[model samples]
Target: MERKTNLIIAFLLLICFGLPRNLGAQKEDSIFYKSYTTTNMEPWKKTMEKMAEELEPGNYKQLFEVTLAWYGYIGYCLGNDKEREARQYLKSGWQFLEQLEEMPEAGAAPHALKSGFYGFEMALARYKAVIFGPKSLSALKEAAAIDSSNVHYLVEKGNQMYYTPSVFGGDKETALRHYEKAVKTMEAGGKYQQKHWFYLNTLVTLGHTFEAAGYLKQAREVYHKIQNLEPDFKWFNEEVWPDFVKKYGYE
Candidate 1:
């Protein structure tokens, strides 16, 4: 009985002592991974979210509204199935912009707001077209009104022209004119400037225009530039641009 009792105690001690060592050894040289979420966000989207959180919507109603408009519009545009959401956001966005315009934000805010509002309006057109028919031209015109010097918007307008019938007002002449204006605006440092996305768009568009105008040098330059970019860049770049450049020689 004494011997059996001693053996039982020894077994209990081994069970408690042995397991953790084995477990610790298993994990001693083991590696774990830290990963980023797959979902991506734009700088503007992040900025908008951050700033919105910092502000008081109730106290600073108008300012808060402007932020909401920007956030909502951008969020809608970025959504996966964004058509309906975009429309809803635009309606809300426009309301905010209108209020702000009537009661202008009186300081450093206006500069960004001016540019951002125009950009929002441009996005609105793209969104509008997805749900309804062809209201993009009008919205583009309105955005141009806010900042006529934006070359990118003009090019976007020109791009939209591609979808419209020639009789309704879409013509290569108009496209060429918009493209030329965009080039001039960029060269002159106009209100509309090129970030990476805009720059890429410009390069590719110029390639297309040059292709049509028989300038393969410009075309190849754009294509190769696109090819050299990181694969995880943007929505269109990851998917559509690869085949697009390959098929047409980037022009």
Candidate 2:
């Protein structure tokens, strides 16, 4: 019972981070992405291959492991097939989740993690709806039930709320709440795998959210903080400044 309880806690935690299907990524992937530059995904490809080689066969537990491995494979695929690869992994994620739910141990952390994994894929599916057809918001709703405080999925959900049309309940106020929750949770946790990106991404998202709400000074501060951290980061000098000028008419 104790072990089962622990598993439940862990699974819920994993789901919180895992189910956010946002294929959107962090500054670390940025390092890899910068290196690829339409020419060098081989490194990414090779890394996924190595990881896949070490994968264990699927079990009722740890199902998300397989899903995650496949996700790595799709994630490494370049350019034209990026979403295709991601979708393949998404399919794999759902298959694992099916098996996971059949057991009474659905309360386990692994099971919860599997939920997160599928939710993540679903979220990505929704975002890629332009290419992949219609989207589904069910993933976020389900994930929140599993673990309301899961920062990773919360962050993705937060972004969707901010960007999605009002017909979809994509309210800026709600999205900002999720984003703020994600930031606070990550900062407090401070030791997760995403610890490295959480701080930076949080600030960037905050800036973007505030900017959308027409808070220029706050947005500038966020960008300025990022610039202080990575003085040469291209997003600030290129994409962000141009957008600021075009939209806000900031000189």
Candidate 3:
């Protein structure tokens, strides 16, 4: 009878202590994904603040996740022309990237992030292009050398190809190829989990690239896939789909 009571206590203790950690791990990913889909930054901001409060030295995984969240937030700021906010986040993001760079456990992810940071810098200051443009490409190349097939590196490379000027070798066709490869690789690796905001964002980018390249049918197909996967995706259902419909007419 005593043994059974002890076993029950231990089981309850395990549930009480262990569940929060697992939930914490899932919470951040879910928060980021929700922010990405809904275009709402308030919840993401709270999560970032909480993560910062909980961060500690040598907590590489936490640091990496927070840094990526910051990256996404900064991108949102830039997209909305909130340069002031983007600049502030960019500074904080660079600090996190520097720490990650010193942690060998971080692998090539830091380099990919560095490439993104440089691109963000350029976006804020076009005059810095001559300097940061090469730096961005070089960092991405280094990231590729380390892990050529890294999903993050593939997405960054596609961004560079898609957004760079034609004079600087930007090619929509090349961009499409890179985006397609990234999407395929991610799908093959079973990376389309519910909390995988990066995979969804990559799909969104691919669809936009298709549209920009005048592949309306392909773009529509990709959008439909996104709709099926995330029916409540606010950015898509509210903004992107409406714009697409306005221009192309509903199918």
* Cα RMSD (angstroms) for every candidate in the order listed: 16.2, 10.8, 1.8
Which ranges in model 1 have alpha carbons more than 4 Å from their true place?
1-39, 42-46, 53-80, 103-148, 190-217, 226-237, 249-251
Model 3, C-alpha of 194: deviation from truth (Å): 3.9
Q: Identify the candidate with maximal lDDT.
A: 3
Ranked candidates, highest lDDT first? 3, 2, 1
- Which scores better on TM-score, 1 or 2? 2
Best by TM-score: 3
lDDT string for model 2 (58-174, tens) is 443234434433443443442245776666656655665566557564433333344345444545555555532223345555556766677656765776678668895678878
Q: Write the per-residue lDDT of candidate 1 for residues 68-137, one digit (tens) a residue.
A: 4364345446446665655665655655544554544333233334444444455556555444343444
What tens-digit string does per-residue lDDT give for candidate 3 at 174-218?
889989998998888753564588889989999999999999999
Better of 1 and 3 by lDDT: 3
TM-score of each: 0.49, 0.57, 0.93
TM-score of 2: 0.57
